[model samples]
Every structure is written in C-alpha cells, then in structure tokens.
Target: MRSVEEHQAVVDGLLPAMPAETVPLAEAHGRVLARDVVAQVPLPGFDNSAMDGYAGRWAELAAADGSPVRLPVAEDIPAGRTDVVPLAPGTVHRIMTGAPLPPGADVVVPVELTDAGTEVVEIRARPPIGSHLRAAGEDIAAGTMALSAGAPLAAAQLGLAAAVGVTELSVRSRPRVLILSTGSELVAPGRPLARGQIYESNSVLLAAAVEEAGGIPRRLHFVPDDVDQFLATVRAELAGADLLVTSGGVSAGAYEVVKDAFATLGTVEFGKVAMQPGGPQGAGTVDGVPVVTLPGNPVSAFVSFEVFVRPALRRALGHASPHRLRAPARLTSSLRSPAGRRQFLRGRYDAGEVSQVGGPGSHLVAHLARANCLVVVPEDVTELPAGAAVDVVLIEGALQ
Candidate 1:
C-alpha cells in the first residue's frame, strides 16, 4: 500500500495553479491575492485627527507650571468637512475624529483633558508635539506594497486595499469541481427508502467540503452501479470542470463502477493508502480534467477530502498556508490503532485535552459531525495511553 504522503504527492502533482481573475472589492474577501497590492495613494490620504480633541501648535500649550491654558477655538472641524484653513498662530481648532488636521497645527489635546467647550476650549494637559495626529502615509506609503501576493484576503486585508484606493483586485479563480457519488443502493434524502437501501449523503457532504476549501462544487446526480451509465454521465459533465471528485465505486467490490469505468484509461491509479478511515484512494485525469476517487462511506469520504483534496485546492488557489492547522494535545483516554494503518479518529478537543468521540469506524457520521478535530496516530505506533501527546488537525472552532 502507498503511504499517505505518497498518495498526497500524486494528488499535488495533478493540480496546477489556477489562473487569476479580476474581481470587485466586494467579492474579493476570502479569496487569495494573485499579485502584490501596491498602494496608489497613501493611507489616511491626508493628515487627520486620531481623536476628538483640540488641534493646535505645541508651543502655545507648554507651560512650566501645570495650569490650564485656555485658547479661543478658531474653527470647528467635523469629519467630511472640506473647507479647512490653516490654524491661527495663537488659536486652536476643535476637531472631530478622522477630520483633516488643518495646516500649521502640530498637536491635538484630547477633549477629556479640557472642559467640553465648543466656542472656546480650555486645554488642561500639555500633549507632546504631533500627538493624536495620523500622518499621511504613516500606515502605508504611495507606490509601496501594501499586501503581498499569496495572502488570503480577510476583512482587514480588504479594508487595507480600500484604504490604498484599490477598487478591484486580481485573485486566483476558484476551481470548478464536479462531485459525483455512485451507488445503486443509495437513494436521495427525503425520498422513500425500500429494503436494502440507504440515504445518499456523500454528494452533499463533499459539496460542502469543496465550498469550504474555496472550490465551486457542482454535484451531479448519484449514478447507479452501471459502468456504461456512469461513463455517460461523467462525460457529459466534464466540460468546464477543473477537477472531478467521485465518492464510492473505487473499492474492491463486485460493482465498482468508477474502477471498472476508468481502469482501462491508463491515466488513473487506484490503490490503498496506509490510513484507517480513508484507505481506498484513486487519482487520475478524465478527459484532461483531474479526478480523485474517494471511498463510499460518509466519514471516509469526508476524511479523504480533508486529508488530501483540501490542501490541493488551497495550493491551486494561491494560499500560502495550504494545510490545516495542526497542534499537539494530550489524550484523555487510551486507544489502539490498526497495526499497519495510520488512524484519524474523531475527537473532541478543549483546553489542550483531546478525547476520542467515537470508535475508529468509517461509518460513524454522527460522531464525525460532533467532532472538532481529528486525532492523528502514526502507522508505526499501534497503541497510545492516556496523557499521550498526539498531533491533532483542527476541523472547527476558534483554533481552526
């Protein structure tokens, strides 16, 4: 059997970086930057007050004795006021937060330090020169790089771009992924189930996982265990797809539609990896589009995507950190893994302590749903005792 890393390397080799596209600033959040975001204009475009206070020269307020110095408020400046004149030499300006500092003003004394006066303010404290003033380009200078390439655009990043006068951004395009789940005995949810039939859920699970990984998922209807029909369905849906992910029909079963359909293509490789929940794996191309086949069980399929597909999607999307955050946590209970397979058990982690949520079974979807992390055990180690420090991949919550 191939090791987990070996299978991952194969998947990585199949995916190339996606091309970049221009998107409006409103749609750029959660996307990856394709190029460096250089500032066209400096942040704070003009010098502004950082607080609601009085703007004046420092020399007029400085006194050897700690006494109140009252100055006539020469002007009242609120945010968005455009007609700003230079400060009178002996007077101060009552300024609101984010209002432009008039020319010739060197410092601002906060309102709390003086009586709340609109006409004439008494400045009780001596503020240092240039205090409470936000200088132009202090945060970012014009023509300087504001955000580097390969960084994920979050609220703060988008705000920074807007601050630098960027209306649109070039970002890596989200990959279009076609998701297919195959099983003759599987029926869609909300439909009547006959004897020997189960609800089809892999497509829904995989689609959500694809979206979370920054891929646009298109879920095709579940195909039965007929090779001819599966091939027809896949061929019809291959257009415009960057990646194809099929759940089920790759295992060594009597009716393995995916294996039987693609085995003769010579491009796909179907094999097993040394992992407990997601052992059966397949990677290849179908009509020039990359394909990955995962096991049929819901938990197994989810785990496979988490272990392999998510990283490849993130890397193609130009994310700098393509892997899930992993941390070490002490186990609260003992567990034994399979002798030769690495185990990824559903776990509940809190305050640095992690406990297995359920048995190491591939069909425990409910337990998987409640889990916040996956406790990873190496292939070489079969048994672990309580208090053992194990590496865990955070799946949800604040840490993730």
Candidate 2:
C-alpha cells in the first residue's frame, strides 16, 4: 500500500498549471492573478477633499485665534465636479467630500465648525495646513504595482484594481472537471427505489466538492457496472475535460468496472493507500487525459477529494497555498484507530477543542454533513486518550 503523501504527489503531477486568460473585473473575483496589476493611473488621480468643508488659505484662517473667521463662499464644489477655478484671496470654496480641491487652497475647515451656510459661511476654528486634503498618489503612485502576481483576487483586491482604472485582469483559468459515478445497483434520487437498489449520491457530492475547489464540474449520468458501456461513455464525454474523476468501480471486488476496463488498456493504475475511509484510489492518464478514480461511498469520495483532488485543482489554478487550512486542537474525547493506517474522523471544532462528530464509518453521510473539520489520527498510534493534541483540517464553514 502507498502512503497518503505518495498518492497526493501522484495526483498533483497529473495537472499542469492553467494558462492565463483576460477576464472582466466582474468575473475575476476568487481567481489568482497571473500577472502583477500595475496601476495605470494614480489612486484618486488628482487632489481632492477628504471632508465636506470650506477650502481656504490656512494663513488667513489661522490668523483668528479662537475668534470666528468669516469668509465669503465663492463657489459650491460637490463630488465629481470638474473645471474648478483657483481660490481668490479673502474667500473660500464650499467643498464636499471627494471633490477636487481648488488651486491655491491649502486647508479645509469642516462645515460643522461653521454655521453650515452656503453663500456666507462662518469659520469658527482654524484647521492646520493641508488638513482634510487627500493628496494625489497618496494611496498608490502611477505605473506602480498595485497587486503582485499570484495573489488571490478578493473584494479588497478587486476594489483596488477598479480604483486604479483597471477594467480587466489576467487570471488563471478554472479547470474543467468531468465527474462520473458508476454502479449497477444505483438509482437516481427522487425516484421510486425497487428492491436491492440504492439512490446514487456520489456524483452530486463530487460535483459540489469540485466546484468548491475552484474547478467547473460537469456531472455525467451514472452508468451501469458493465465495463464496455463505462468505457464508451467515458470516451464520448472526455472531450474538453481537463480532468476526469470517476467514483466507484475501482475497488478489489468481483465486478470492478473501472479497474477491469482500464487493465485491458494498461494506462490507469489502481492501488490502495494506507488511509482509512479512502483507501482504494487510482490516478493515471486515460488516452493522454488525466483521471482520478475515487471510492463510491459518499463520505469516502468527499474525503478523498479533500485529501488529494482539491489541493491539486487549487495548485493548477495558481494558488500559492493550495492545501486546506490546518491547525492543532485538543481532543475532547478519546479515539481509536487501526494500526498502520491514517484515520480522518469527522469532527466539530470550536474554541481550541475538537469533538468527534461520528464514529469512523465511511458510510455515515449524515455525520459528515454535520462535521466542520477532519481530526487526523496518524499511523503507528492505535489509541489516543482524552485531551490529546491532534491536527485538524478545517473544512466546510470552519474557517474563521
């Protein structure tokens, strides 16, 4: 059996970095920057007022020590106003927030300091020189790097790009993943189930997981356990798919269609890993296209994706930190695991303590739904006492 790290490396090698593509700023969110975003124009672009106040010469305003300095309001300037004139001596310009400052104006006294008048305003106090003035290029200079390459574009990054006059961004493209689930006894959900048939759910689970990992997922209808039909269906749907992920039919069973079909072609390899809940795995190229076969159980497929496929997809999308966020938390109860096999148990983590959500059963889909993290039990340890420190991989809404 292979170690978990070995299988991870195998899956990682299957996908190459995606090429960069120019996308509109509206669609660039959550994508990694393929190139540095250089500012085409300086932030703010020109000198503007940071407050709604009167713009005047500080020397004239400061001459009144605690006395009311009265000045005639020459003009009204609101935000987005252009064609501003220079401030004439002995007068002030009533300027609104974000309005461009008139030339020769060095200070702004807030409207609250005066009587809030429009034509003839009263300046009650003297503001310091350059007060309430947002200087040009104060946030970012023109032609400078606003955001570096390999950065994930989030709300703040997108806002900064727009502020610097960027309408489009070059970002790593999302990988297109095709999901296939095969089982002869499987039936679709919401349909009547006959005897000896179970509702198929692996496709839905895998598709959602793929999308959460930043890959576009296309789920194919579940195929029967026949090897020929599976092969034909896969070949027909492999066009334009960056990665083909199939659930089930790869285990050591009598009618494992994936293993049986691929064995004849001698392209895909199947094996077991030294991990509980997701031991049966396969990763290889099918007709020069990448393939990853996962277990059919719902919990097993989800765990396998979180362990192996999610990180690989994120790395291919140019994310520097591709792995799920992990932290060490103290266990609230004792746990047991089989020797020589790594165990990932469903857990609920909160405030430095993690509690097991369910037993170590791969078929417990309800328990997996309630879990926010995976408590990892390493190999060579069969038992753990209460209050033990174990590593937990944060998932599902566990990120703080």
Best by TM-score: 1
Give the alpha carbon lDDT tens digit for every residue of 1-400 in model 2: 9999999999999999999999999999988898898999997789999999999999988755678988899999999999899999999999999999999999989888899888888888887889999999999999999998778899999999999999999999999999998888899999999999999999988898888888899999976667887788888888999999999888998989988987778888899999999999999988888999999888889999999999999999888789989989999999999999999999999999999998888999989989999999998889999999999999984423
Q: So what's the TM-score on candidate 1?
A: 0.95
Q: What's model 2's lDDT at 245? A: 94
Per-model RMSD to reference? 2.0, 2.5
Model 2: residues with Cα > 4 Å off, grouped in runs: 63-65, 127-129, 380-386, 397-400
Q: Candidate 1 residues 32-65, lDDT tens each?
A: 9999999999887899999999999999898612
Instruction: Report every candidate's CA lDDT.
Output: 0.92, 0.91
Output the worst ten-in-a-row residue range by lDDT, candidate 2.
391-400
What are the per-model numbers of colliding residue pairs?
0, 0
TM-score for candidate 2, residues paired by index: 0.91
- Candidate 1: list runs displaced more than 4 Å: 397-400
